[model samples]
Target: ESPNDHINSHSINNSINVISDDDVAMEDVIDADDSAAKHEQIIVKWICQRCTLVNSEHSDRCDVCSSPR
Candidate 1:
């Protein structure tokens, strides 16, 4: 009859320990892809042939994916 009698922390610890290096690598790749996908405003207009993503024509890089022109 104690206040702490009904706590289930065993499963939580097991789950935390189950994460593998592959999971971490996949997460990093996803994060990198996401970051590379963020748009940066460009003053000039440009076109992306691969993705159809547009940017400033005078811009050296694509705003949507950072692809070099």
Candidate 2:
């Protein structure tokens, strides 16, 4: 086989592996969503010092001004 043919086959194999990995990740995401729906998540609100924009507690920076929290 030519070098080009070998490279093409290798890339095709890699793509197949990536697709399978993505399928597994999707299943995990679905499971996580189901568990999340079963629980109540508390989201704390924070006000930005510079822009006075209200942001979620999970965020490290202000959404409007991009100021660090």
Which candidate comes out best when scored by TM-score?
2
Taken over the whole model, the C-alpha lDDT of each candidate is 0.44, 0.49
Output the lDDT of residue 9, model 2. 33
lDDT of 2 by residue, 1-69 (tens): 677865543344222111122112111221332333332233356677788776766789888889988
**Model 1: lowest-lDDT 10 consecutive positions:** 22-31
lDDT of 1 at 5: 80
Question: Candidate 1 — which residues are off by over 4 angstroms?
Answer: 1-44
Global lDDT of model 2 = 0.49
